[model samples]
Target chain A: MTRHYNFCAGPAALPTAVLERAREEMLDYHGRGLSVMEMSHRSPEFVAIAEQAEADLRELLAIPENYKVLFLQGGASLQFSMVPMNLLGQGGTANFLYTGIWGKKALAEAKQLGFAVHMAGSSEASGHTEVPTQAELALSSDAAYLHYTANETIGGLEFDYIPDVSVPLVCDYSSSILAEPLDVSRFGVIYAGAQKNIGPAGLTLVLVRDDLLDQRCQRIPSLFDYQAVAEAGSMVNTPPTYAWYLAGLVFQWLKHDIGGLEAMATINARKAAKLYAAIDSSGLYSNPIALRNRSRMNVPFVLADERLDKPFLAEAEEAGLLNLKGHRSVGGMRASLYNAVPEAAVDTLIDFMADFEQRRG
Target chain B: MTRHYNFCAGPAALPTAVLERAREEMLDYHGRGLSVMEMSHRSPEFVAIAEQAEADLRELLAIPENYKVLFLQGGASLQFSMVPMNLLGQGGTANFLYTGIWGKKALAEAKQLGFAVHMAGSSEASGHTEVPTQAELALSSDAAYLHYTANETIGGLEFDYIPDVSVPLVCDYSSSILAEPLDVSRFGVIYAGAQKNIGPAGLTLVLVRDDLLDQRCQRIPSLFDYQAVAEAGSMVNTPPTYAWYLAGLVFQWLKHDIGGLEAMATINARKAAKLYAAIDSSGLYSNPIALRNRSRMNVPFVLADERLDKPFLAEAEEAGLLNLKGHRSVGGMRASLYNAVPEAAVDTLIDFMADFEQRRG
Candidate 1:
């Protein structure tokens, strides 16, 4: 099979090894005569898989004992409302720091859930080109939590420093999770959709400090209650078993073959640096985000000549690069370099960009 | 690899052919050089898979154009809260007919969602031995919708007759969906978790009438909003793609090899009849549910000599049959003859049961 470099934000590229493992085990998981998809979540085999996945993830992130790891469905989008519903308590508010599309959508969902949300910081006026400085944020004293998106996929912006706040810190780390090391104890909650850097689109990973779990209203649905799911080992309901299993495979692959997050961070930084340097040097391409705040995971750039946008994408596709188109909200091109992305793919992308630049120049 | 007949209640057995196909295509789906899990949901390749899956499902069920089929995550458990959150607008009451575990769980979730819910009828007095007769039901005329579980996996009960109600009828067909034929027009909505009769556990299927969708409360999260998901073609959020793809394969299998729901019903009936006859003929075994109300999909029975229970399960396991253990709530054995269960497996089960009974009689 011909290989293609996928630069899609996510449901993005996964390690070829993980996919091959899944293929080998798809028909008869560990000689159990059933696919992992066919195994009962309650079975010892699946329970072991779920537990190992959680353990490996905790080890990778250095998650403290006080934090619970949950594998949930409905993506991080569901977590937008779920965070407020579970943590905002009754008649409380959350302070939101808007960096890009995901943060804005999360706050919007929280607002609908009756939270008194305040935009503590925003870069909307600058087309989300920068993450606001600490001094620029206006966090509320009465806020139940401070919410932010760690990496903004659409705007190609990222926060370099964790916010030091009196209130609980909640972050949507969907785009950048597991691509680097994280201090799990620094936040009250860190939630990520699995598609980008984890495993698949359906499963979501939520790391929550146990203390924050008690804020659920009595009326919250059991499935949406983080406390309940955490207590039940994320099996309060039948989980997306196949997704969980695949995620477990990815976790194992990440730990054993791909190296731990510390090693992973080095490769990630190198890839991001190479691509960013290329964009910065090129006369034909420009990334709008402020340099210090630019994302190491997603690099969104515009062709110097806006009229060349369509042809640029067409040429990129022909070069076996796919999903380079930017989000509709931010028109241009976006190359999402998640953890599974190889440095070689980045080299190929850099080569393509250079060739395209020389021709366009 | 040695094959075993897996009898898991859910995340259950799939046809061997389906598993083989998934294994063969796991790494490179239809020559796309990407696992279905790694494909962008918006890509033409993935979209074609999604569209074809839906088309196959629509064809299998003979779903009307007015009824929108949605592929969602969070399982049917999420739908429990979602159903009431969307349909029970302005705090109106919804009627629930509780037969078993799933029905009770659904009711609990709906009630927690702030819906004024009434238990229209319940068979808890009989340990859910039978579905409540339509004549004995106490449905409310003011109910926004009447909800029922088509088949209860845990209690092994099933509603034999479709209730003729003036209100919109919603059935949780999680354990029995696609196991038999049905007129889609008879119900306002039908939902099923994709484990038992469908493909896997992570994906949930919802077939809803177009007109019943408008009652969504404005506060509903986009992921939980039936109208929003229906409008977006279940892509309102990132769906469980691999599970969805597997479900499509099962749908195609159902349409071609299994000869659709009508043919499925005949085979299922024969399988159920064979198992029921063995139970009835054996003096050492019995099923408590009334014959007419007994679930053709799940047959739960107990050994007359309770001491033989452990040996029965152990011997069955040795005989290559697995997960025949009944739900903890009801201590016995349950063989779930979902659509994927071949008649030959049922015959093997019946023969085993008879031989055990004869030796112990």
Candidate 2:
């Protein structure tokens, strides 16, 4: 079977090996006479699978003991409301560092839920070209938490350093998470939708400091309550069981075959460097983000001649490299190199970019 | 390859043909060179898949043109809140008919969200042995909607008739949906979690009337707004793409292979009749539910000697009939014969039950 390189922003590419294994085991899982999708979530068989997925994730991220790992639904967007609902106990101001579209949308959702939201820093005025330096940010002392997107999938900007602050740090790491190494202790909460570096779109991963668990506002539904999900081991209600199963397979694939997060980080860095170098060298293409803040996962670049954008994407599709179009908000080209993207695929993309540039010149 | 018949209540069995096709196409769907899971939700390819799924569902249910079908996330539990948030305009009362655990949970969530909740009728006092009669129900004239569970998975009860109501009729068809023919136009809204009769756990089906779209209460999150999801064709957020895809496959399988809803109804009736007849004829086992209101989808029964429960379940497991234990709230045995359950599997279960009874006697 032909395997095209998928570069969709999310509901994104998965490891080919995981998909093959899932296919082989689709009829009956481990002699259970039932597909993993058909098993009861409460059954010992499934409980073990869920627990192992969580354990593997913890090991991959080196998650601190003080944090609780939660597998939740409703995506990262839901977390926008859940984070404020859980963290903004009795109501207080929250600071936001706006880098791109995602951070803006998240802040908008938080504000609707009654948080006194403040823009600590914003790159929107500069077309989201750079991440704000610590000195340039205006964090509030009275803020319940400081929110930021670690990597902006749309604008393709990424933070190079953790913002030093006294307030609790909450980062939407939907795109950049697990693409490289992370210091788990640096933040109060880190949440990522699994579609990118993790697994599928249905499961959302939230790692919260244990202390943060007790601050949930009462009257929130049990399903939205972080404390409730954490207490029930993320099975507060029936979870997205099939997605969780696939995620388990993904975790296993990541740990054993892909080499743990440390090795993954090296590969991710090399991949990013190769693509960035190609874009910088080409007269026909340019990535607008400030060099220090350019995302290692989402590489958004525009053709020097804007009229060639559609033709560029069509040709790339014909070459079996798909979903290279940028976000509608930023019309150009984007090649997302998440963990599942192989080095050979990156080399292929670079080669195509060079050939295209030469042909256009 | 050996395939064990799965009898899980929800997250239950899927058609074997669908599973096989999914497995075959898991790596490269129709030469797209990417699994359906990897496709972008907004792409034309996935859009066609989503639209086709909705069209197939519409055709199967004979859905009215005045209604909208929404594919949503967060399961039926989220709808417990979303229904009130969307339909209970200005804190209006919504009448509930509590057949079992699901209705009570939905009512509790609506109450939490500030809806004036009233119990029109409830069979909980009789241990949910039967659905309430029309004369016993007391739906208010000012009620925004009247809610009921069409089939209770936990208590094994089902409605014998649709209640005549001036206000909108809303039903949670989580377990019984698609197992038999349903008149879609009779209700203002119908919702079902996909785990039982549809496909997987992460996706939910919502059919709402056009009139219900105008009742949105302010301050509901856009993601939770039924109107927003309906308008966007459920692409308002990154949906549970893989779950939705699988549900589409199940819809196709049901339509073509299972011979549509009428055929499904005939098969489901036969399966239920056989199991109920066995329970009635044998002095060794009894199903407590009232005959008229008993669920065709869920068959809950008790051994004459309650002490044999453990042995019965253990022996059943050895015989390859799994997950027969009843819900913890009511201890006995429950066989959820959803649409995917075959006649032979029911026959196998009956044979085992008879043999076990003879040994005990």
Number of the top-ranking candidate, with TM-score as the measure? 2
Docking class of 2: medium
Best by lDDT: 2
- lDDT (tens digit, per residue) of candidate 1 on B1-361: 6668887898889988888888888777777667788888988899999999999988888899999999999889988988988887655688999998889989988877777899999998877887888888887767888999998898788888998888889999999888877889999989998999889888899999999888877777778888889888899878888888989999989988888889999998998988899899889889999877899988899888889999999899889788899987778899988888788888888888888877775
Quote each prediction's TM-score.
0.98, 0.98
Model 2 residue runs over 4 Å out of place are none
**What is the C-alpha local distance difference test score of candidate 2?**
0.89
i-RMSD per candidate, Å: 1.4, 1.1
Which candidate wins on DockQ? 2
What are the fnat scores of the candidates, in the order listed?
A: 0.74, 0.69
In model 2 chain A, where is the ten-residue run with the lowest total lDDT?
A214-223
User: What would the per-residue lDDT of candidate 2 be over residues B1-361, giving only the tens digit for each residue?
Assistant: 6787677897899999989999999999999999999989998888888989999999999999999999988889988988888897665698999988999999999888667889999997887897889989898767888999999998889999999888889999999999877888899999999999999888889999998897978777778888888888888779999898899999999999998999999999999999999999998999888999999998999988999999999888888898898887888899999999999999999998889989993
Error of 2 at B146 (Å): 0.9
